[model samples]
Target: DAAKEAIYARLKKSEAGAGAMHFPLDRDAQYFEQLTAERIRTRYVKGFPQRFWWKPDGRRNEALDCRVYAYAALHGLLSMGLNLNKRVEALPPVPASRQSRNDPRPVTAPMTASPRRRRMAISSNYI
Candidate 1:
C-alpha cells in the first residue's frame, strides 16, 4: 500500500545513517522495553535541534508571531519498520454463550412456610 510505503520511507529518513538505525526483534516480549530505552537515549543524545520529525508535517512551524515545534521520537518508526511485513488481523468476536449472567425474569414474592414446633415430645413421627 502507498500509505505503508510512505510511512516506511519517512522512518528510514528519520534515522538516517545505517549504523544509527535500530533493528527491532519481532514477537519479542522485551522488544518495547528495549526499544523505549534506545529511543530515549537517541533523543537525549540528539537534543531538540538535531532531531528530525518522523511525519511529513511534523517539522517546526512559525506563523505571524507564534512558533510551534513538536518533540521527536523514532521508536514508532522502528516499530512500523519491524511490522511492515506482517498483516494485522482483528481478534475474533466473543461467543454469546460465554457472556455474563444478567437474568431478566421478574422477581416474585417470597413464599412463606409454617414455623417448626418448639420443645415437642418424642412422638410416633420421631419413632
Candidate 2:
C-alpha cells in the first residue's frame, strides 16, 4: 500500500518525462538498489523506459548514441553487449578551402561545342 502511494507520487513528479533519471550500467545490484531507494525516497519512482538516439548517418549497424550512452561508454561503465552488423569507416578531414572569388564574369558568346557536354568531379564532405 505504501509502495503504491510512493509510485503514484513519483509518476506525478515525472513531468520532464523519462529523461529525468538514469541508471549507470553495472552488474552490481547496488546500482539498481540505490536507484530505486533514491527515487522512492525523493520522487517515489522506479524503472522508466529506455531511450535511444538514431545515428546521424542513419546506419542501421552503426547506431551511435549520444547523451547518456556516450557518457556511459566514455567512462567504461558500459559496453554494447549485442553483436552488431556494421562497418566503421574512417571519415577524412575537411580541408579549409579558400572562398570563391567574388569577381564577376563578363557575358560571352556560346562556344560552337555542345554546352550540355561537361565534366563533373564529385567530392565527399570530410571533416
Candidate 3:
C-alpha cells in the first residue's frame, strides 16, 4: 500500500509539473525500501514515463498512450530484474542531423506512424 501511494504521489507531482519524475530502474525490492520522497521523485523523472511529457492540461500529448505502455514496460522490466539504464545505454544514440528543423514531429507521432513507413529509415524508428 505504501509503495502504491509513493508511485501515485510521484504521478501526481509529475502531472502537475511540480518536479521531475524519474524513478530508479532497479527492480530489487530492497531498493524501494530506501526511497525517500525526494529520491522517488528523482526516480520517477528518469523513468520511461518521463520521456513522454504530459500536456499543460495534465493530459498525455502523445498519441501512443506512452503513459500506459511505458509504465507497463517499466514494471515488466522490473519484474525481470532488468536494468533500464543499461538497456538505454546499450541502444545507439540518435544523431542530431536526423531531426528536421523545419517541421518538428509531435512526440506521439512515431508510435502512430505506419509500421511500414516507420521502418523506411532508421531515424524514423523513433522520429
Clashes of each: 0, 2, 9
> In terms of lDDT, which candidate is stronger, 1 or 3?
3
Give the per-residue lDDT of model 3 (tens digit) for 1-127: 3433445467556353544465445435444432322222322555543322223433332322334456677778699888756666665665576556443542221233587766786676676
CA error at residue 7 for candidate 1, angstroms = 8.1
Candidate that scores best on lDDT: 3
**Candidate 1 lDDT:** 0.34
* Candidate 3 global lDDT: 0.47
Alpha-carbon runs more than 4 Å astray in model 3: 1-4, 14-73, 98-127
Candidate 1 has its poorest 10 consecutive residues by lDDT at: 63-72
Error of 3 at 105 (Å): 5.6
- Could you tell me which 10 consecutive residues in candidate 3 have the lowest summed lDDT? 34-43
Which lDDT tens digits does candidate 1 get at residues 21-106?
Answer: 33333435343332222121114444654433333233221220111111112345455563422322233444566454454333
Question: For candidate 3, what is the TM-score?
Answer: 0.30
Give the candidates in order of TM-score, highest first: 3, 2, 1
